[model samples]
Target: MLAGAARPRMPASAARSRLVEPLSGETRLMLRAAQLYYRLNLTQDQVGERLGVSRFKVGRLLDRALRESAVRIEIVHPAARLVELEDELTDRFGLGGAVVVDVASTGSEQDDELLARERVAGAAAVHLASLQPTGAIGVSWGRTMLEVAAHLRPGWTAATEIVQLNGATSQSARPTRAHEIVERFGATSGAAIRLMAAPAIVGTPGLRDALEQDPSVGETLAAARAAQTAVFSMGVLGPESVHVASGYLGATDLAALGEAGAVGDILGRFVTRAGGIALPSLDRRTIGLPLEELRAKTLTVGVVAGAGRGPIALAALRVGCVRVLVTDEATASWVLDHA
Candidate 1:
């Protein structure tokens, strides 16, 4: 080998002895920036100062790290028992779907109201949206139904119609009590709404006969008869129940109902323990669709909750009043275990 020329290049290991072992300043700064930016949660300027580089360089390094897929983020939801409860309800009731919300035992009044309203509305929206392009959809009124109306979707175009199964009175708070619900259905599906303007309860059986003769109310009642699907809630007897809460029944009226072996009600008509509609005196005056007419529909969904309502729900199921039911977990469990 020549003296000036390298001695035929020592082995590769010998070459390493002449090379630098430490990383370059730029390489070290890039790694330091990555750690500070992601792990330490420092600003670009702060990371740059620690690495003795400009903030611009630190920003570039972060961008590179992200682009190279060096960082990954993930999120997971905590497991809950509500899912199991939902499944149990669907299977037991033979329902197409179900949702059970977690309500605090000592939750505030406002919270409870919000929870009830939200659940009812959510269920209504889903069911209404899934209606066939051409069919009748019947609705009944109560606090829960009112809340459901409040949350109904604003616009729809599914080719349907809204028929009021029950009457709303002139003495009532509003002639359009169920107007929001019908309007929502109409808006979303472009369906016509048939309005029933007769009083839910008239002065007398004679008065009811006179009102039913009105063309407008008669037409709405006819539409209700042809309904293919209906949505309603079970009513409980007494002053604290929804009927009383909605001011449809006064204190004395409720007392009278209790004396008649009325345990619950549906669409303002009282029901017996066996779920048969009672109140021979008031039946003729009641303007809602008949129980048999409702049964004729292809789908009848009844949404109800509360532990005290289990018996009525069971009775409704027994009498073939409700083929599809949407209820809370506690109520659903009680119905399956007890009813």
Candidate 2:
């Protein structure tokens, strides 16, 4: 059945439908399919019959329509998730994709942070799992990454390899949980793990050079560079940051980094608001893949939560270190508003 010469009448089920945007060709067909399946309350078979195609083809077209924005579904409810925020973040930041998790305050600041972290991590884990990633995946170690690992289901990937993107040896007695983060990701995926057994920052550039020269460290760094996909978290510059808590940096160092316009750290390397190295001296002692290398990766998913994390997240997006972002609603809104 062709969409013929006669002006098509809006079906009874389409009373609430409206054409808000212009489309043509395949997009027009997509919109038609969407209208038939959604507004007209037609099943895939019915829609396909009207459109003169197989039901399987209709399914693919409907999926493509949603992906291409031929149709937009808005959920209206008291607790409706703000799906638009994800689109806005991707558009505003030029991101490849975004996942925004709905998070409500839990009354206590501590509980709220914990809940938000879990929500954001769960979203990231699901997104990663959906990708069906294989081969070497570069990852960073931190609280956020740990949460992400915890949320990942078994066999998230097949025959994958996990490479630590940066040195994780903490200067303090408190555990960085760095190894645990990589190991957990590897264990779930049945992957081969390559750990960077060294401090994130050494006392001097020469010491950093000597450590990188080691075969084990060099091999891991090489794998990190070659991996096309990476997942990590942005670290806000603050007293509560993992670097400070793990003793990789101290109060005086944080003060220096702040004075240098550092907004956050990516892969343990602090960067400015404009995504430039915040401090050359500090970065020289840092052991990890350079910030510029991140831009070349096929996928770099940055998972960050908490209101205070907005600046770093924005910096990561602007710098092109992160292609996809998984974060809570408040943080996403904050990034969009501030960006």
Candidate 3:
């Protein structure tokens, strides 16, 4: 060795590039120490003593191994496809606005939690906040709709009146109460809430006729009919569905709906898979804007999700019930595939 020459300190064992490489007993023991120290939250000294290495050597090996392993991390933002999907749906449907969320299935609990967090309520709240404030806004009721109402931003406009598009009632205690929904929207928008205080389903046609004659209900219905924009969701059939859960439909009611060949319902009007509104029963008792009136609105925004609802949503689209649609990517792709 040359005089005054410094010697580099070499590792006791050769560094293994791949984790699968044959490691010496000491190297293997060092790796185990590093894992125990870092992963298991033990101190370097504790890991070193446990693995029979000096604390200094244990620390050096841990640092070198981690550096060589080089775990690549990345955070992907929401894709431009989201905005493109919005634009495409808007152009195709002549919608005022559209919001499409990315709820792609990742086959994980975290993904499901993330999907649930993408509620239509937040999107609707944002949409309502940006409204131009011109005409009355009609609203329909459902769990998704109620979620929208809850997220609505407060103090929008006092002049902007909210009209309920359907009667508020059900067999159970908590029916599709339009008053609660309307009031929530009113509170958010600072607008007058007009509620149709009638049963969702009356006992008889005679009773329905008598209820419609009430001036208060008639006035509210008129307001709903004249509204330029309406927001609603397509309801699926079944016991645990939103309608059933909201107490708007009992088992017998659902059976009757099924017998009527209803694939889904919109504003309590049963419709087929082809989007033809069936069930004269809906026409007789419901105190709200008719299908024709709903169709006439300049903007009829339908917010719905789930693979099961894709058919109903497509049917609604085919029938021109929805001029604007807000949904997740899974449902959109399903609609296109099925279409």
lDDT of 2 by residue, 184-290 (tens): 99999999999998999888999999889898799999999999899999888998888888888977889999999999999989988887889999999999888
Which digits, one per residue and each the tens of the lDDT, describe model 3 over residues 50-151? 877788988887876677663222335676777777877677656666777777576885655345335655676666566645578888887767767777
lDDT score of residue 335 within candidate 1: 70
Which run of 10 residues does model 2 get worst, by summed lDDT? Answer: 15-24
RMSD of each: 13.1, 11.5, 12.4
lDDT of 1: 0.69
lDDT of all the models against the reference? 0.69, 0.88, 0.72
Superior candidate under TM-score, 1 versus 3:
3
TM-score of each: 0.66, 0.77, 0.69
Candidate 1 ranges beyond 4 A from true positions: 1-106, 131-133, 154-157, 170-176, 245-247
Query: What would the per-residue lDDT of candidate 1 be over residues 239-274, giving only the tens digit for each residue?
Result: 667555545667776676677777787776777776
List clashing residue pairs in candidate 3.
Answer: none
- List ranges where model 2 is wrong by over 4 Å: 1-81
